[model samples]
Target: TLNSDTFTVTKVYSDASSDPQVGVSLACDEGGPPVTVTDSPQTTTGLTADFTVTGWTDATQVVCTATETSVPPGYNSSGTCAAALSPAGGCTITNTLNSGTFTVTKQYSDASTDPQVEVSLACVEGGSPVTVTDSPQTTTGLTANFTVTGWTDATQVTCTATETSVPPGYSSSGTCAAALSPTGACTIVNTLNTGTFTVTKVYSDASSDPQVEVSLDCDESGSPVTVTDSPQTTTGLTADFTVTGWTDATQVTCTATETS
Candidate 1:
């Protein structure tokens, strides 16, 4: 009389809290029908299916393999799929979550030179936020890399950038809210501040003051102004100057010379 033996297949998940559970199909080399099962929610336990086959003389060897038919949104199968039937007569398959990487960049615009500004980048997954700093920035900009492991593939991640320290003559602008993409980047922008300068000339000897010429020169280019005061009187003379483009903290020198 040929006796029957039972073979079991189990599905195990590394992340028990994973939603939309994973499913797998199990098959054996022996003449038993294939069985399919879904993983249990508990990490310590697994879901199982049993197959009964006849013709076992105690020397029969059986091999089984498990294949993932469906995976959760953000997970991948990362364990051995094939195994020989153990003395206990069962096999297990494991599934692991997936991970991805991205970048955060800082950019400066409208500035005469690189401000070398410092900034902070914050990225958030479902859990806590991850923050990093980029200092001594350049005109070409700076970048920071981030890697998030053990996350589901469909999970949404967000990032934001802030200027920790702004240069004396610059202002920040533009939107920095970025969605995470593999090998992608989020950028922040800054512009230079602008203002006007006024120069006033007062003559100590009003009645006898000679016709004079006044000139103003700045260390930075495109910031020079010259004015002529003819037939000077008791009232002082004033000249308004505006820098053509952007200017940082600069040194200005003014001089007056008698023309008559």
Candidate 2:
């Protein structure tokens, strides 16, 4: 008995005339062209010469593709046909006429090195949102790059950056967004956000005991704190306590008592 195998490669042109010439290449788990095929839609066939198929067994499937080496004006050469070749198998490579791109960038503010956290970047295209995490929290400042390539012509993409974890002593710069465009950039900035204040507690005359139990109420009831020492002076705090106690035998007067 004799075996039979047939493989064909076809070219898909952008224009009705198929005025441009294109190069088509094919590769299989076996091997083939490096072959060139010119096509014309004007012709009733609308296809190029078939790639001579050989060395394929009776029931073996050949993996192949047809790619363009050159294309017509206003047409892109990014189209290709990838398929498994079977007996009498044929594939078509179309010329993509139009395309565009979109890019996103993650940037930090010029604030001092107060420690930065990782920022997450999101890109939305084709009605789907994909998120990419930037490098881990930055000690210094840093910038990250993100790009969505090979977009269809005139397609709009949205890019955004948000801090994954807002560091302490700083407030979120908030999420930032870039205007929609084929190839546009989105930038996010983080600024220093904080405030400073001193805490001081005043005590009234309580008891005359040599050691009085002084309590400081800072937050709320049910939660109490005891300050053993009076006149406590810290960088952000200055607590002063006053209590009547035995001063001199002759003069028994209540006065502000302070302990260094």
Candidate 3:
């Protein structure tokens, strides 16, 4: 006479509520040959297979083991895969989810001269927001890193950056945004401001000199401008000067000299 026993193997997720249809295989060493069975779509309750034995009085020791063939994306198998068969039932295998990480690199348009600007970085992933300011208080090229381990493989994350305070002579422009990945990067830019000024020349004696040439010198790094007083009238003469890409903190001084 022969006896038959039913054995079962179950697959489960540790971090997820629903099954991800992981692939599993069960191998059992019978008396003569090894019987192998695979589950097409592994469920939480598992699949059951029947095994044949000699009889109830048979002394054959049967061993069954379960192995994972395929796992869900962004997840890893962290459970024990091997088990010994008994009259009770079979074994249960667990799959764990993996964590994801990303980085944000901070940049400035005037990093060469003004690198002490502070910026606020924020990141969100379907949950609470995480914020971090520039490290080292005052430094150039700062970075903020984030690590999230509770999300599934299909989750998406977004990060944004904004200037905490604008510098004296610069204007804040575009912001930074990115879809988070293992290795992602973004940039924020600021533009230097510009303005114009005028230089006026007046003559004490209109008839004394028919025409006079005057040289103007300023603190700004530029060639001196020579203005020719034409008609030598008492009315004031004016010259337009433009300063491009200057900051509010810059100090400007001007001086005039009579060349002729």
Candidate 4:
């Protein structure tokens, strides 16, 4: 019959900056002390060279695995364990880290020189919101970039932008859709509050005489109406108002009536 044998388990890191701590569990024909590992730039703990177990029957096999509890930030505990082992056999497990990048873009529909615009970004990963500020008035448009390191691959990362400050005469565009991927793009568009309205003048009588020199006045207290011809155009007028006009003809002056 063969004498008792020994087995060992080792831990390693692809990235030295990854988790510094590792743990292990062993099931063997010959029991041993609790196994634990800690990683460092100089040396990684817990290997046959670093740590070893003794007293297993000569041909008896040993099964070992890396425990996942308390994994370090940005590191995966899913490191694979080496194949089943026997006398004098060794196994190695490796921890991994993740990384990626994303972009954010801001846009305005009108050519207005708004002050600096600020957007807020957040993630479900439990970090504080990141603020991205841009002076659209100076840049014409704005784009920002972000990089994520140590996040698990395939882990859903979401980023959203909200307008914190706006230019004069503008309102917030609200929040945008949460960015779907690490490489995804988030865009926000702001619209000008001011718009144009068309005014058309209709004559009840076509024979009213185009040269009657009709004087048009708007009810907006300080607003001025520009008189050109039959259909005079008013500019820089805001809000709703009533239009009043008069003809130079004395005969029709008294009989002139204002209609909507």
Question: Which candidate number would show the highest lDDT if scored against the true structure?
Answer: 3
Q: How far is candidate 3 from the true structure (C-alpha RMSD, Å)?
A: 9.7
Deviation of model 4 at 133, angstroms = 14
Residue range with the least summed lDDT across 10 consecutive positions in model 3: 224-233
**For candidate 2, what is the lDDT?**
0.45
Ranking by lDDT: 3, 1, 2, 4
- lDDT tens digits, residue span 18-119, model 3: 753646666666554664443422443333323332233332366666667666654677534554455544777677665554454545554644545465
Deviation in angstroms for 105 in model 3? 2.2
Q: Give the TM-score of candidate 1.
A: 0.50
lDDT string, candidate 2, 103-152, tens digits: 33334343445444366556665656533334223434444454433334
- Clashing residue pairs in candidate 4, if any? 47-51
User: How far in Å is the alpha carbon of 177 misplaced in model 1?
Assistant: 1.6
Candidate 4 local lDDT, 157-260, one digit each (tens):
56665666655334456666554353466776766443222343345774433322223332223333222232333332222222222111121111112232
**lDDT of each prediction vs. the true structure?**
0.50, 0.45, 0.52, 0.44
Model 3 regions lying over 4 Å from their true place: 6-8, 14-16, 20-23, 36-60, 78-80, 87-89, 110-142, 148-182, 189-260
Instruction: Report model 2's TM-score to 2 decimal places.
Output: 0.36
Q: How many backbone clashes does every candidate have?
A: 2, 0, 2, 1
TM-score of each: 0.50, 0.36, 0.45, 0.44
Give residue 125's error in model 4 in angstroms. Answer: 4.5
